[model samples]
Target: MTSDSVLARKPSGQSDGFEHHLSPTAAQALRSNPLSAKATSVLSASYADSDIRDALGLLDKRGIQNTAETRRQLRLAVQKEVIDSNGDIIREFGHVAEQLKRIGLTIASLSQGCEEMKKHISAAHQETAPVLQEASDLMKQKDQVEAKQQLLKAFNAHFIMSEEDIATLTSTAEPVDDTFFAVLARAKKIHNDCEILLGTENQQLGLEIMEQISKSLNRAFQKLYRWIQREFKSLNLENPQISSSIRRALRVLAERPSLFQNCLDFFAEAREHILSDAFYTALTGTSVGGEEDASVKPIELVAHDPLRYVGDMLAWIHSATVSEREALEVLFISEGDEIAKGIQAGRDSEPWNVDGGNDFDGLKALNELVDRDVTGVARVLRQRIGQVIQSHEETIMAYKIANLLNFYRITFSKLLGEDSVLLESLTTLEESALNQFTTLMRDHVAGLQGESQLAPPDLAPPDFLQEGFKQLTAIMKTYETSLTSADSREADFEPILTEAFDPFMEGCENIAKHLEAPARTIFSINCLLAAKNILAPFDFTSTRLSKIQDTVDKHTSTLVEYQYSFFRANSGLQPLLQALAPLSDTKEDLLSIRSLDAFRPEVLIQASQTLDDFLPLALMDAMENLKNLQSSKMARKITEEAADRFCGDFERVEEKLVASDDIWEQEADEETLASSQPLKSLFPRTSGEITVLLS
Candidate 1:
């Protein structure tokens, strides 16, 4: 090849290949060859100008044409330069060659096989075109015929489908969409129109048609219910489609004379399905009638049962009944009628038999299945409640008692009217609970009249009684809402308050009858007063208004007499006055004695003896009796009387001493002075024990 052609064929310097080791002769030949310069010039474009120029400068400095040894060295250098520049490209080329050898043959076979398969598939499509086209045309025609038949079925009244027939047709209908919705609507309308048209002309024919539709709807729901009972543990009754279906069925049946009976059956059956055992347990944590045992009564259980359980049950029934009632009202009954308002029960609304002239209850043999209204359910609850109260009796607590009454009250307000017997039942329950509480009060106070000693002034009945009062107070608040009479509020609380006050009165009576000694009678009366004071906040006075005044008057009189007698027995004043005889022959002068020699030693000895007899005993007795006194006023009064009497005696003795001192001073007599000193020494200071005792 020419030099330029060879350079282009192989990469610039790669035209001449390297060996494992370069021979000296080959290196000498490469150094003198003009191709090296040509190759370097060609590779100049691939490298930076500085690198190429430096390499060329080193070549020039070493001399291009040198000795054979130097030239060999130059040739070795050129060989290294060429190899380093092309090393990556050479290694990559070798790796690509190895990979191609390993997998290229298999890939070629795959590509050829794919091409062949594509050809065969195209040929198969061409072969089946006519047959597929014919099948498509046939399906289109069948669909058209089926659509026409559905349209005919939708409009034709005579084409009434049985439950089984509809089930078969629904399977063929496959996916339910707008078409099926339209079909159902049209079918519903056709049935309605036919019944109306026939009834206008031939009443018997219309009745037959109506009965047939009713049976069909009932049968359809019955089958659906059976399947659901078998298949599902729960169903979503809130689903709009399910609700719509029920309502539509109700409307169809309601237009006929048999509206009430049919709705009643449907409602009862639907409720039965919805109110499963699992559902009940999930809601109430107990079975339908609620948990009961001989030892543990349902009344207590009812108290503990969460209010939400009743509220939820009531809510579900109310919602279902209201929905069904609304649908029925759209067809048969006027909005204002008793039946529409659910005031007239379904069982009562049944028509009289033409043959017997006797009315039939709507459910016939299945009357128990039908719940007449929420009121009827509440009535059942009331019945159970009565049993509970009868069985539980005294075992029920005050809050529980109030709660039972409140449950009835709140429940009646939801579903019952003023005229409902359930409301009367509620009143009866309230009266029963109140009476029970009254009985409890009577039992609590029954022994009060037999008590030997009065209760301490601050002593109350018990915590239970207070709790009972609180519960009763709460119950009264509920009563005000339920009873709605001003007099009723008064009547209710007055009786309860009266019962509560009886205990205190009995305690008072026991005090009077049992305590006979003067001191104990005084003490007993004091205790009664303390109890009255304790209960002052409760307005017991008002409750006992007629009798309290008389009670107070009698007790007050007894109190005064006993206190006066007590003072006389304990007083030292009597003896002191007796000893200090009328010094100037007048009763008023008795207190005016002011001389040391005014009286005989017998008078002094008698006064001293009177004080010695009474003062210590009186002071010690006062100390001992301090706790028994009713009030601080009574104790202080006793102390003051003693202090006044003793101080007066001391003052008189001091006056006598001072007068004697004046006589001694005038006479300057030792005998007078000696008598005065002895007299002065004989009288004790008034400020000492008297002051301490008074204070």
Candidate 2:
């Protein structure tokens, strides 16, 4: 290879070839740059001998110069270009080395300055370390002092009550206004918060504060109680508008139950005197001031009319009760929750205030107060009403008074509870009146049971029973309009029933004993039916009416049997029945006409004649027998049922006779049977014929 090709080729395992072709510096440059080596190889390959010869030939054909001079000049130009490039590279290296020397000087100066800064920082840290630690500790102490100051401020605000608050609570000079309530509430809160303080390690502050608050609250409550008592003393129940101050004071004072109840007791005592005087004035037209008002008439003006007198007295009491309740209602009803809390506080402080196992109830308290106020009025009412009931001899009037008492009893129960003195008085008076009525009835019934008074000839109910029923009807009418609850009306009226109707019925039975069997049954039926009809209009008397109906049914059955027996004997079937009754247990052949004397042809013919005679008038006579029965429907029903039963007996007799006829026909020859009547011809009346006649 030529020298250029040898320079372009990479040195392989043979170092001699690469060393012989390139100088040491050139070979080192080629080894350092593989890309430059590959480029030289490509240039060498392009300029091969054949390519150079082709180029020389083309140049000769083109008449251009192709000589060794041009080749030598190109080689010299390449050497000169490489020398210039090396020179440029040496200049660039010199510039870079100068710049690096300047950078090293700058770095040395920076290193010396850093050492000085490190010494200064170390001295500054050593000088300021204690100062920073002291500042941090001072800040921590400042925070702790601030936190404690804040805690003290909050503690004072929560647990302390001001002198102004204490004065508002305990000073009677200050009115019990909204401000007073606010201060009282704050005091209460302070009192409650002290409990938390008591739970801590130190309880001295809590105990001291609790004692101070307790004294203040007690004084406040005493003032309120006294104020309420004074207000009640000056209160006018005639005008039903109580002042708001009194109501608010009452609600607050409920916290101290002993004081609150003492105030109520005082108020009730005052009202009792006032109402008692008012009632006496209304009754006698005599005022407490001892001057009679011309415009006000005394209820005693109507004393001759016992019902109107008693009613007027009770009416006055009821009106007074309503007015009293209305006047005082706001004191108990308004702000009930606050009042309940106050009462609970009172219970917490004073456990003995809870009485009779009853919790504090606003409405119940109002009722009890009202009852106490009316205590005097109730005593007068009971006495007067008792006198009227004892002196009244009219049975109906006495029963009416009892009803009036019962009406007032229920009215007062609604107003003042069932246990109130007013209600108890009314109940006692009512019972007394009812007993008076019962005694009157018993006396009347006893008089009716004498020998001189007997069942009427017509077998109708006696006049006394009718009169008693009329009175009973009136009593029932009064009771029906009473205020008793619907579910309880039946039981409520039972005593009245026993006193009135039962005694009348007993009188009827006693009178009935004077009559014969059928008459007695009819009389008893008439009385029972009368009682049933009188009691039928009221739904509450269903049980009593049912008992009366049962008696009527029993009596009706007896009357039916009596009428039926009358028909049987009057129709001449009694003897025949007697004979048939014996034959019923005998053999079939024994039931023949020849077996009994009563069934003989002559006897049968006589019975047939009697039956024919009676069948035509059976129902009319039976109806006439029970004509005295008060219920015409019942009379007709009894007549029909009895007639029907009589027809049934006749049908049985006809059946027996017909059956005997068949035996007679079989037993007798035609001559004997023809001479003696056939059983059918003897008893010619069939049950159908009898039934038709009765109908």
Best candidate according to lDDT: 2
Angstrom error of the Cα, residue 565, model 2: value is 3.1
The most accurate candidate by TM-score is 2
TM-score result, candidate 1: 0.37
lDDT of 2 by residue, 357-384 (tens): 4566788888999999999999998898
Task: Show the lowest summed lDDT stretch of 10 residues, model 1.
Answer: 361-370
lDDT of 1 by residue, 1-695 (tens): 12233235455443233421558776666567789746544543543358856765666665555457765686688888889879978999999999997788889999999999999999999999999999999999999999999877864545465554455324433333334344444444545656675647667756766676555545443443333233223435334344343333333333233443454555545555444432344334566667623442222234454233343443444454445434333423332343322212222333452322443332221223323333454455456545555554452353255445655565544433445444566667666656666676577566544444543443333333344445445544444444334444455456555676555555555554654554544454454455455444443234444455456546555544544344334543343344444444342343244332333445555545554565555555553444455665654565455445555555554554455435446655777565644433444434355445434
Candidate 1 local accuracy as lDDT? Answer: 0.49
Distance from true position, residue 619, model 2, in Å? 4.4
Candidate 2: regions farther than 4 A off: 1-166, 199-202, 236-242, 293-297, 302-304, 350-359, 584-592, 595-624, 630-632, 667-688
